[model samples]
Target: MDFYLTALLQGLCLSGIALGIYISMKIFNIPDITTDGSYTLGGAVTGMLLSNHLPIGIVLPVVIIAGGLAGVFTGLIHTKLKINPLLSGILVMTGLYSINLSIMGRSNIPLLNYTTLFDSFHFIADLNWNSLIVLLFIGTLLILLIGYILKSDYGITMRATGNSEKMVSALGVNIDRIKIVGLGFANALTAVSGFLMTQFQGFTDINMGIGIVIVGLGSVIIADTFINWMNISSIWISLILVCLGAILFQLVLAFTLSIGIDPTLLKLITALFVLSIVSLPRLNLTRN
Candidate 1:
C-alpha cells in the first residue's frame, strides 16, 4: 500500500508533463517527439543550476524558457524551412541530446546533497505526506493555468490553427506565429515537469527521458478512453481527466511491479496500454 501511494504521488508530480503532451498532441495536433529529449534538457539545466547554488524559484523559470527555446527552434525548422513536424521534432530532440550532455558536463547529475522542493517539505517527510501534498498543489495549479490559457484569445487562435491552418490564415490570423507560440508553450510545460521530477527523485539522468513520449501518449489516450472524449464538456474537465489518467497509469505500473514484473518491461507495457486506449474508439465505431 505504501509503495502504491508513492507511485501515485510520483505520477501526480509528473502530471505537468502529461498536460504538456496534451497541449501538443491534442490542442495543437502536433506529434512532438521533442518531448522525449526536452524533458531531459529540463532536468540537466535544473540540476546544473541547483548544483551551482541557484535558488529553485529562479532556476525553474529558466529551465522552462530553455525548453521553450528548444521547441521554437524545432518550430522554425518545420514552419520556415518546410521540414516535416515529426522530422523537425526528431532533429531538435537529437540536438538536445548533445546540449543536455554539455549542460550537465556528464550523463547524469546527482541531487543528493542539493536542496530541493522536497527538502522544503522535510517536516512532512516523516509522515510520508509531503510528496502527495506537493503533487496535489502543483497538479491543481497546472490544470487551472492550462484551462485559463485554452479559453484565452491566443489559445483560440492556437486551436483554430490546429483545426485548419488555411481557415485560420484566411481569417487573418498568423498561423505560423500560432504554431510557434503553441509549440513553445508545450515544451515549456514539459521542462517545468522535468525540473519538478528531478527535484522529487533526487537525480537527473540524460537517458531518463527514453520513451517518455509513449508514457505521455498513454496517459492522454487513457484519459480520453475512460472519460469518453465527447463527455468532456469543458477544458477544465479534460485537464482533470488527463491528471487522473496519469495517476492511474502509475498505479498500474506499481501493481505490475509488485507482482514481480520486470521493471525494464515498463516501456513495452506503456506502448501496449496506449495502443489499447487508441483502439477503443475505433472498436466502438466498428461495432456500430
Candidate 2:
C-alpha cells in the first residue's frame, strides 16, 4: 500500500510535466525536447535557491522564468531561423546542460537539510497522505489554470495555429509569437515539475531530467488514448485525465518494480512500456 501511494505521489509530482507535454505535443504539434533541459533547470534553480536559504515563493518564479527563457530560445530559433522544430529543441536542450551546471556550480545539490515546498503542510497525520493532500491541492490549481487558458479565445487561436498554421496566419494571428508563448508556457510547467520532484525526492541530480520527457509522453499518450476511446471533447475533462494518466504511469512502474523486476532494467522497462502505449492505439485501428 505504501509502495503504491509513493507512486501516486510521484505521479502527482510529475503532473506538471505531463500537462506540459500535452500542450507542446498535442496542441502545438511540436515534440519539444527542451523538456529534458528545462526540467533539470527547474531542479537546478530550486536546489541553488534552497541551498542559499531562499524561500519557496521566491524560488518558484525564478524557476519559471528560467525555464520559460530556455523555451523562448527554442521557439525563437525555430521560427526566426526556420530550423526544424526538433533541431531547435535539441539546440536549446544541449545548451541548457551547460547553463544548469553553471547555475548549480556542481552536478548535484542535496536538500535534505533545507526547507522545501512540502514542509508547509500538516493537515494529515500520515506522512504520505499529507503529501498527497498538498499535491492534490496544487494539481487542482494547475488544472484549473491550464483549462481556463485552453478554453479562451487566445487558446483557440493557439490551437488553430497548430492545426493549420497558414490558415491561422491568414486570419491575422501571429503564429510565430503564438508558438513562442506556447512553448514558453509549456516549458515553464515542465520546470515546475522539476521543482516539485526535487523537493519530493530530497535532492537534485544533474542527469535527473535525462529522458524524463518519456514519462510525460507516456502520460499524455494515456490521456489521448482515453480521450479517443471515450469520445470526449471537453478540455476540462481532458486536463483532468492528463493528471490521472501521470498517476497511472507511475503506478504501472511501481507495479512492475513490485513484481521483482531487476531495478537496473527500469529504464528499459520504461521505454518498452511507453513504446507499447504509443503502439496500442494504432493497433486498435487494425481491428477495423
Candidate 3:
C-alpha cells in the first residue's frame, strides 16, 4: 500500500510532463523532441538555483520561463527559418544538451540537505503528509490551468494551427506566432514538472530526461484509448484522462518491480506497452 501511494505521487509528478507533451503533440500537432532536453533543462536550472538557496517561488517561474524560451528557439527555427518541425525540434534538443550541461556545471546536481518546498512539510512530519499534499496541490493547479488554456481563443488558434496551418493562415491568424506561443507554453509546463520532480527526488541527473517523449506519448495514448477519444467532452475530462493515464502507467511499473522484474527490462516493457496501445486501434480496424 505504501508503494502504491508512492507510485501515485510519482505519477502526479510525471503527469505534468505528460500534459505538456500532450499540449504540443495533440493540441499543437507538433512532434516535439525538445522535451527530451527541456525536461532536464528545467531540473538543472531549478536544482542549481535551489542549491544556491533561491526561494522555491522564484525558482519555479524562472525554470518555467527558461523552458519556454527553449521552446521559442525551436519554434523560430521551424517557422521563421522554414525548417521542418521535426528537424527543428531535433536541432533545438541537441543544442539544449550543451546548454543544460553549462547550466549545471556538471553531469549532475545533488540537492541533499537543501531546503526545498517539501522542507516546509517538516511541521507536519508526524503525519507524513507533505509530499502527497504537495503533489496533489501542484497537480490540481496544473490541470485547472491547462483546462482553462484549452478553452481560450488563443487555445483554439493553437489547435487550428496544429490541424491546418495553411487554413489558420488563410483566416488571417499568424500561424508562426501561434506555433511559437504553443510550443513555449508547452515547454514551460514541462519545466515546472521537472522542477517539482527534482525537488521531490533530491537530485538531478542530466540523463533523467531520456525517453521522456516516449513516456509522454505513451501516457496520452493510454489515456485516450481508455477514455474512448470520441467520448471526450471537455478540457477537464481530457486533463483527467491524461493524469489517469500517467498514474496507471506508474502503477504498472511499480507492480513489475515488486514482482522482482529486472530494472533494465523496464524500458522494454514500457516500449511493449506503448506498442500494444498504439496497435490496438489498427488491429480493431482490420478485424472490422
User: Least accurate stretch of 10 residues (summed lDDT) in model 1?
Assistant: 119-128
Candidate 3, lDDT over the whole model: 0.86
lDDT by residue (tens digit), candidate 2, 107-209: 9999999999888668978878999999999999999999999989999988888899989999988889999999999999999999999999999989999
The TM-scores, one per candidate, come to 0.96, 0.98, 0.95
Per-candidate Cα RMSD to the true structure, in Å, reads 1.5, 0.8, 1.6
Task: Give the C-alpha miss distance for residue 213 in model 3, angstroms.
Answer: 1.3
Writing each residue's lDDT as its tens digit, candidate 3 over 1-288 gives 888887887788888778988898988878999988898999999888988999888898899899999899989999899999899989988998899999999998999889987885554563226787877888899999888878888877787787888888998998888889889988888887788789878899889888888887888899878667477767798898998888888898899889999999999999998999999988998999
What's the true lDDT of residue 169 in model 2?
91
After superposition, the stretches of candidate 1 with alpha carbons farther than 4 Å from their true spots are: 122-127, 227-230
Better of 2 and 3 by lDDT: 2
Determine the backbone clash count of candidate 2. Answer: 0
| Predicted structure with the largest TM-score when compared to the true one | 2
Q: For candidate 3, report its TM-score.
A: 0.95
lDDT of each: 0.85, 0.94, 0.86
Clashing pairs in 1: none
Mind giving the per-residue lDDT tens digits that candidate 1 earns over 15-81?
8778888888888788999998889989999899999889878898899899999889888888999
Once fitted onto the true fold, the runs of candidate 2 whose alpha carbons sit more than 4 angstroms away are: none
State the TM-score for model 1.
0.96
